[model samples]
Target chain A: MASRSMWRSLHYSAKRRVVSPAQYRCFSCSLRAQDQGKTDSEKMTHFGFTNVPESQKESLVGAVFSSVASSYDTMNDLMSLGIHRLWKDHFVRTLNPGSPLARRHNETEGQGWNILDIAGGTGDVAFRMLDHATNVNHDRQTRVTIADINPDMLAEGKKRSIATPYYNTGRLSFMEANAQTMPSIPDNSVDLYTVVFGIRNFTDKQAALNEAFRVLKPGGVFACMEFSKVNNDLFNAVYKRWSFSAIPLIGQVVAGDRDSYQYLVESIEKFPSQEEFRAMIHKAGFMIPGRGYEDLTGGIAAIHKGVKPLA
Target chain B: MGAVILARPGRSGVLSSLQKAATASSRTQCRQNHFHPPVQYRKQELPFRAAPTRSCRLYHSQFHPRAPTHEYTNSQTTILSAALEHIPSHGFTLEALTLGARDAGFLDVSVQLLPRGEFDLILFWLASRRGLLRAKVEENQFESLRSVSSVEAKTKLLILERLKMNQDIAHKWQDALALMSLPSNIPLSLSELHALSSDILTLAGDSAVDTAWYTNRLGVAAVYASAELVMTSQKPHADFAAIEAFVQRRFEDRTALAEKITGFKQYLGFVGSTAIGLGRSWGLKI
Candidate 1:
């Protein structure tokens, strides 16, 4: 209402022949642009604080991940001050991929869980789950399929996996796949679906969630660990100052890429609060456990879990 | 303010926020009627808002499509209830909680769900027993208690029945008592105690909604707490005979105290009226 009247006054003033800077942002221009938009039907989405065409966001995000692929581990350590490791560790342990109870079932005669780690480009979470399953459960039959949209990230992940005992173990595999649609991965196939710090980057979050629900077995779990809205005012202000100022500078100095880290920082702010995302999961037809999401480090990050309801 | 700061993902423009904040007086009106600009100006003016996600009351409600309003999850309840079976061997310790989680087919670390660690386990037992006590009273509220004459006698039966419910776990009750007395744990412990006493009052059909209602509940709480203390202290066995006699004597003393208070109130009322009558006769404004 306020903007409309302001525009009306600006219009009357322009009609009086007093050319103003407001004329450049005149509502008539926007109306003309809206008229043109009806012909093209271009959708827009947030790329970092800027609005870009929806179709272009994927490539823009891909470029950032490809650039940060090699130093992703180091950058994660630097950005969260190595707390991301603990968050990821807790995320995996919460699911407890290969526990003794599951091993005792022997339904498939020692055939293990079909874990799908989405946007698991650098294999940070995938490697941890495999390590946990091997060391804790001692059942080597469990397999993990790491799916990523970026080839550069997958290459970096492969290089890292060579350093661990899981290299070429046949228990680990990598595939190129978008989270929104994966024809290669069939329905009711996955036992555990994990996306850590990755769901926020998707162009269509609900579509991705629907795909997760489609791929999960009746009782499979969908777990996501992401940088969420910080709950504390003082902490959030300090974090914003650190992220908006310090992180880009660190990225510029160490990685020589301020833009990617800046995108990373803005993306965290763009992600939903812990509660909203939990509702999205619930809306996608998964049963929420407890309050649906667990806050970590004063809610700077949260773990959201949902189980596919069995009919 | 948190909601304001989180609005409009494309709020990277300089002039737009200033314009909105300066011109917009009421935020609730502004949020409901957002003025979206064209695609080109959206980045420079109003950000393209996503379809508003459904806002839910941040509390658990039956109609709300959220998790159930249970203090503990099904798995947690299973683990805790199973943990009760191991109380005789392991007491109210973490070992018992862990053993219970394992027996419930959960991972050893499943005990982490009980965030307060062992204290939550203790709270679970206390709350569940209170639930059991309610069931017991409701079951025999009329059937067995019709023979017991007065409300006092019926209330006595209820309190003694509650005390006897603790007999199976009497040996382990000492540790539960110690945990409940902790400063941090006292609030929950006291609330449980408050619930039990009130349950006894309502079950005995004491509908006194005046000051005596409070006194009655408090009286029951005192008698039960003291009697439970005595039961836990007795070695080799819980002497129900002595506990029953103790409850009987405590009720008798409570009745005497009530009579004294009532008599005092009546005497005070009589004296005040008499003084007022003398003032009226002396022509003062009584």
Candidate 2:
């Protein structure tokens, strides 16, 4: 039995590969300009602060992640002063991916808990979730799939996962997929769906939310953690100055890519406020109560969650 | 805005200042990761020590979730009303919508609600105002006008009422008219025109099933669109009396032309049927 278990672990790890961006096309081009029978110039969407053809947005965002893939984790630490780890920890705990509720549901369904972590490149959220599920809930059967649109980011995550015990235990995997549509992921399959600091990069956020609603089981949970609007004017002004002026300079010095970091900052500034985002989650047919989000650090970052109805 | 300028501060100085601000305002400092044994595991092991503040509101998970459709429409309405306030100064443009949403206490991302931005809001404003006009007509039981029996009189009254309704926005309507004339917005403008004409005919007690339905609606729509163009071409200081006179004259001219076309169509139908009857009697295929 021990030998069989070891063989199974190796087989699962061997199944993982870094998928290239070229191999991954957006599954549903419903909102593409060409699909709408319009010329590229006639229908434009925002690529960071610049307006570009809607079809070109995906590749532009992909190039950004590819350029910063290797140094991404270190840059994150330096940029946020390592406070990002605490936020990730809090996010995973709040999710409680394999807590008693998940276990109970898994028991009745006769399967291990499954989590689909979209755009979770570098395995930051995945590792934290695995640790929390294993250490806190004593649930070893919990599994996670880190899906990202960029292959270079996935390669970095794969390299980092080689030393972790979850690497070959059939507990972790990675896939190249777009948030707008994941055709390979079947309906009513996931126990939890999460996207950390990633949804704003999607060109069609409503379509992505609809896809999230489709892949989850009737009682699944949807959680998102991203930069949000700060309500206090004084703090907001200071934060804006710090973000717009300093972060890109740090990126230039540290990562040697100023434009990509500039794009990241612009994307954060363009994200919806906490309440508006909660309203969007509600629009996607999830069941959320009053003020269905929690703000962290005075709305600098927030965690919004909703549950799929059992019906 | 408090402009804080530091004289020739180095990169390290900026980083240090940011660090100091972060640490003083919040306990978000990084700590060493501690992986504990199973016996030492505790729910409170994480270093999330910040107390919940008033910046956010928390709700229990068990309460009923409200559908957001109503909220979405409410926000759009608020944004439209705010946009109207800026139209006089900036005209109908994306900048107006952006400033309007901000003035309505909405964040920058509120622009997402209107994917096409200014064009979408303009269409929304027109449709919403048309709805209000219909409501007003219904409330007065069609007695708000001087005469509802004759097509010319009725068209004149409807046009005058619409101009009156738009009196506050008269100066800005010229810009809106210009935007609606763009190639991309032409279809939307035409559809709104059709809807307005249909409403006016309905208030005149004209059933849409009549043979003259399409012709009547099209005629009225053209008259309305032209009258609007003429009204907007007037100087900003022009009185409503001039607009009312222009509308009456335009209505009289179009109404005569419409009556002539309707009579010609009836006469052609009579002659064509008579010809068909004669051809059938002569054993010819009709």
Candidate 3:
């Protein structure tokens, strides 16, 4: 009931037409708004819609993932109307592991593809990539490492992988590592680094991009598929209304968890638009090809690609 | 103004409409950042309403749109420019781009850097030639253009100057035209064409922010395209005189049509004012 009341107020606050200022600025809302100057370099970052200390965001996000880890895929299907499946499938196909596209210059020619799937905990993308490399390309040397910040999510992935042929084949690996800091991953070791529906959750998206740049070899590709700002204003309005109202309600009725789902919606809202994110990628020293992105489903989601410059 | 602002070599940060929308998006992001959103875009900030966006938008240069083909990297500049010399012999093919890669001291596989392949070579040729034409006009290097005073005649001079650039590679351009017309490449190709027309207009001092602006650019683009088509159909060096005559006639036709439209508009204005005066005489407030 408290979640329902919060949703009602948040919806009103987003509109700011029906709800009065006093009604919308609940105790925590005002605190977050005017509390900017206390931290140096403004360590305050968004946790869902409200601003929170950057130090606490990791744990807050971890809690959200942990609560929803088992039902993560199910929720994704429900929220995106199962369009995420098609997006992920298309993403892997675009990457097209084991193809000559994976080879950098000439060195990694015969060793097959070395791919790092960042924030890909569920093995959804990793499995598909391995399958494509195996069944489609007829190349058995391709390998995928799934990295995620949430252990619960990784565990869910590991559990799901038990039935697949890649379990004992040494083609799959999982790492519980944050996207912003993957210290265990050596520099320039990967040919293709992919982050699907991720990179937005990080407290500092630029840091994650820098990490991605650091890990990829020269001539290596970086691909990302994430929810992006809709190109059409009318479509964006409908998307916003649907996400804001239907998603949290669905979360509450199904998983009995509202805050996690609300956080998901607000984070998408807070994430940088496609153009802004492309600029960030450029600042991180990645060379992107034409427009840097391809809008899917009319920019409801976009796939951004960049290549590390071969100096 | 949507005019050409000359960029030094390897600094092709042209003002694309995408970048303009990016600036607008940053303002939207700024508004969305706060609970009580602050107003942006003060009317006073726009010093030159005639030029809706130019020097003013650079205040937020941090929000680079980073769109492709706008800002070529040093290596892309090197390879693409080197690739241009190979085009007359290689006819905008991958072989020329590969030879260019070798000439630029990069590996043969480095041609992969230009992912669009042969089409990228043609774009580099178009963009570099446009830049050259702008430089020629900017430095007042065109002796023919110095004789012209009005924007229309100067525009014709500039069009001929631009078309004359194809003398060396005019034979190879049919393939480039085919590549530019490909379904996938059409948007970028059309944009390059639009940029060329816009540059020619700006250089000719056509800053009328009205229907004339659109008509003038469209007229210039039409004349240039038809003239180039006529050039490609004939022998290169020998047919330039014919191409120039064709351009001159097209420009004359366009100017005549524009004059007719202006005369018609004036006639309509007279009728409109007469009706308004009649309404006033009938004691009706307009």
Candidate 4:
């Protein structure tokens, strides 16, 4: 048994190799440049501090998720003072991800029940929603399928959930998927679409939003919980100081990893503002007829909700 | 600023010493070639669960293993090389290069064992420096990496050389011993290994943007070789500190073209490598 164990360990050890950069193309950037003969929006990407071609962003983002998958949840809580949970909760509350029961008839199954949580690693949102849904109505089955790019996050969620009070019994399921190109759920099949702390990580936010639009059922709700600018100048200054200083330190302490946290901080700095993001959602044809901004401590975070018009 | 500089002299020894300590830790672990013994004494460490890789879908073992027993190959390198095989051309444009390097850095940093050891941790730090360097070279972020004076560069080089030599020597000795031959010994204690790795990781992270500035300069120059560029860009320094000084002194020379070349290389090299290498590995094309 001992020798067999050694042999098995040897077999597995050599096979583990460093993951190289993921390969992808920015067809949109290329096509736009070629067709219009203008290179303004041609192709651009960020490598830490430098910005380059759009094609490179995908793999860089992929690597970040892989490194952070394990300590991701823990860091999130620590860095944000557990505010991220509130942000996610705010998103869920705004989403109200369930079918409204019948009005006239004795019983009417709630419509618009399917939700796709893109980049819902570890099923944080899904798990929370499961509890919320169960509390809302036991009879009406609301399915929240989490789609994340990192398999480790999904697997971790699987391992953790199995031990949780709700496992396969919960209304939550997970799938590995890239936010830009999620093909598992059929078009116009989802009633609510959500991506929390995930939008800024994408190579192309526009492409992701468009994907969200394509998958949502008409009149579906789309809500995103992400780090947003805190409006007050004083608050902004304090936040920046905390983010650049204490956040990385916290990561070092808790996760035993700081670069991953550094990336998270940098990502927040690089992310588009709430208004600019709202504009993008509008561009995706989501009517921002009504919107709510939950500035969890001066724009430290904001949950933006938009709706796809039935027409 | 004065206090900071003053503090630097006192702190420098400790930083370098910490790195040496890390080297010592790895060496010790190498000597003790067995699974890390469960600590009867608990330290203030994060509880690590089984980290899943592509093949090892589920971690069945209870004890979180520290190092992969020679079985851990650079999967990213393999994936990249496989991707490279598909691409016929060896070179790419500036933008593509930058993008590729960024992606490669991300993947490289992401896949490595978490809480990496000192030597391995330097890679990401170097990558961040490369990114910042690229920004500076592009002139978009001027003043990012001022050319260090020859003296400064030389001094920096000396320290790095010392560390690298120590690492190489330690590794060579470990390899010669076939440390794995022992069945009962554990690798280095988790505390000792993590302390050194995290420090180097910070060091690398702090300097990555700057180093990248130099590497990016090399990457974007129509020239492919780093050594060749180093030979021409600044006078040869006796050590890392001297080189840093030289680069610092040249800060004023500020040729727009030089910056452009560096910037272009950083961006293009990164993109091209990732798109051609990783993309191909994943059976995709850019």
Query: Could you tell me every candidate's TM-score relative to the true structure?
Result: 0.63, 0.47, 0.55, 0.44
Which run of 10 residues does model 4 chain A get worst, by summed lDDT? Answer: A1-10
Stretches off by above 4 angstroms in model 1 are A1-39, A72-74, A102-114, A130-143, A168-171, B1-132, B139-142, B149-153, B159-190, B207-286
Candidate 1 has an lDDT of: 0.68
Report the alpha-carbon TM-score of model 3 versus the true structure.
Answer: 0.55
What is the Cα-based lDDT of residue B75 in candidate 4?
Answer: 29
- Provide the DockQ value for model 1: 0.03
Query: Candidate 4 residues B155-205, lDDT tens each?
Result: 233223323332212323222123322342123222222223222222222
lDDT of 4 at A122: 64
lDDT comparison, 1 vs 2, better candidate: 1
Give every prediction's interface RMSD: 10.3, 16.9, 10.0, 20.4
DockQ, candidate no. 3: 0.04
Error of 3 at B69 (Å): 11
Q: Ten residues in a row with the worst lDDT in model 1 chain B? A: B46-55
How accurate locally is residue B207 in candidate 4, as Cα lDDT from 0 to 100? 34
lDDT of 4 by residue, A120-200 (tens): 766777767766656754424777788877765576568767865567853667788878887777887776787777787
DockQ values of all predictions: 0.03, 0.01, 0.04, 0.01
